[model samples]
Target: MAGKFEISRRSNGEFQFNLKAGNGQVILTSEGYSARSSCENGIESVRRNSADDARFQRKTSSNGKHYFTLTATNGQVIGSSEMYADASGRDNGIRSVQDNAPAAAITDLTAA
Candidate 1:
């Protein structure tokens, strides 16, 4: 099965999206946007930026968990991964995003 993007409204009424891998694991999550259109644009940005390794910023939290953020050409973050136990897992998550995002189908849960 191919990966997919799931868009939904937040409890706060904003919009956000998650990129799920073929096995149904969420590889990346986007920040909340005031408008659904902005959230959709963020998904497109991820599709475009995921192709570039440089667009992925790998980082470690102060407690030492590994994670990564995907950024657009202007340097704004498009999405981020959940904290991983190790760098290897974080790297795998990045690879998953790269492999899956470009052609991922969008499932808009926001629609009634």
Candidate 2:
């Protein structure tokens, strides 16, 4: 299976998305957007920014977990990743986003 973007509604009624790898692992996730269109735009931002290494912000939490945020050209955080146990794992997550986001198909799971 190819990587895919899974769009869904949050419990608070906001829209969010997850970028999953071909093996069905979620490499990246989006912030909640008040509108579905904004959520979709976030996906586009991920696609556009994933290819640029500089667009990814790699950071370590105070608790020592590692994560990454995909930033748009305008400096907005378009997407983020789940915490990883190590920096290498976080780096791998960034690479997964870079490799999969460009061609991932959308799988809309939101209610019609």
Candidate 3:
């Protein structure tokens, strides 16, 4: 099945990209991005790729649930959230978190 992509700006004023597969079933997401290009890059990469990835700034456990966090290069906590399980959950949650941020600008498809 073909996948879908969504882009937005986060509450913390960062860029984010979301990917959905299986006809609207979200499959992967990216953390709060510091730049618009980065977010779009992430989204496009997900569209062309098949792997699932979660880039967390910190790993912690709280309230009987595991929490994942994403930080900007400047040390700001742009995105912080929790996940129920392992990689899959974390990856989806990451995208869920991305929903609040602005969509990164799309890049050149031919660029290397």
Candidate 4:
């Protein structure tokens, strides 16, 4: 199975998406957007930025957990990883995006 982007709507009626690896693991997730087109644009941004190592920003939460964000060339955040228990897990998430994002497919699970 190839990696894919799964688009869906939040309960509050905003749009969001998840980038899943070929093995079906969610490597990254997006913030809510008011419009579906903006969500799609975020996905495209992930695809474009995932190839660049410098575009990824590794961060730590206030609780000390690690995570990462995929940012566009112009510095916009496109996607983010789940909070991880350690730096290794966070790095794995980054690698997952780097490996799976370029060829990932889109799976729209949003309600009509």
Candidate 5:
């Protein structure tokens, strides 16, 4: 789970994780941050990336919004979300990206 982005409970029953994106968007979060870290990870996941690669990438949407993608190897149809922005809209969009990354991770395998 070193390269994988996730929030797991430590033996002490605390949340610990490396909040990150392939590009360098990362943070240090705690138990209360599980939801938030998950959100960040979700955004990183939905930014249109490869399943085999552990690093996450940031992508853009048709509306010119920066976002991310999460891909899984099961060949399923996961959902998508947007990346953060300087404005509230961007933050909201990125929030969606976080919420949808896990779902998006289940999408079909992209072409090599």
Candidate 6:
């Protein structure tokens, strides 16, 4: 199965999206946007930026958990990964986003 982008509305009335891998694991999550269109644009940005390794910024949380953020060319963060127990897991998440995002289908859960 191919990966997919799932867009949904937040409780605060904003919009966000998740990039799910083929196995349905969420590889990356976007920041909340004030509008659905902005959220959609974020998704497109992920698809465009995921192709570049340098766009992925790997980091360690203050507590030492590993994670990564995907950034656009303008240096804006497009999405981030969930905290992982180790750098290897965080790296795998980045790889998953790169391998899956470009061709991922979009599923708009916000549809009424």
State every prediction's TM-score relative to the real structure.
0.98, 0.96, 0.42, 0.92, 0.25, 0.98
The CA lDDT of each predicted structure is 0.97, 0.93, 0.51, 0.91, 0.39, 0.96
Candidate 6 Cα outliers beyond 4 Å, as residue runs:
none
lDDT string, candidate 6, 1-112, tens digits = 9999999989998999999999999999999999989999999999999999999999999999999999999999999999999999999999999999999999999998
Winner by lDDT: 1
TM-score of 6: 0.98
Per-residue lDDT value at 29 in model 4: 91
Residue-wise C-alpha lDDT for candidate 3, range 1-112, written one tens digit per residue: 4444566677897767555443555434468778877766665544332222333453646555555655444443433454556656755665553442333233232233
Q: Between the candidate structures 3 and 4, which one is better when assessed by TM-score?
A: 4
Flag regions of model 2 displaced more than 4 Å: none
TM-score of 2: 0.96
| Model 1 C-alpha lDDT per residue in residues 9-54, reported as the tens digit of each score | 9999999999999999999999999999999999999999999999
Candidate 5, residues 1-112: lDDT per residue as tens digits?
1122444555654444433333334322223224544544443533443333333234666666665433434433223333445345544444543533334322111112
How many clashing pairs does model 2 include? 0
Off by over 4 Å in 4: none
Please give the clash total of every predicted structure, in order.
0, 0, 10, 0, 12, 0
Show pairs that collide, candidate 4: none
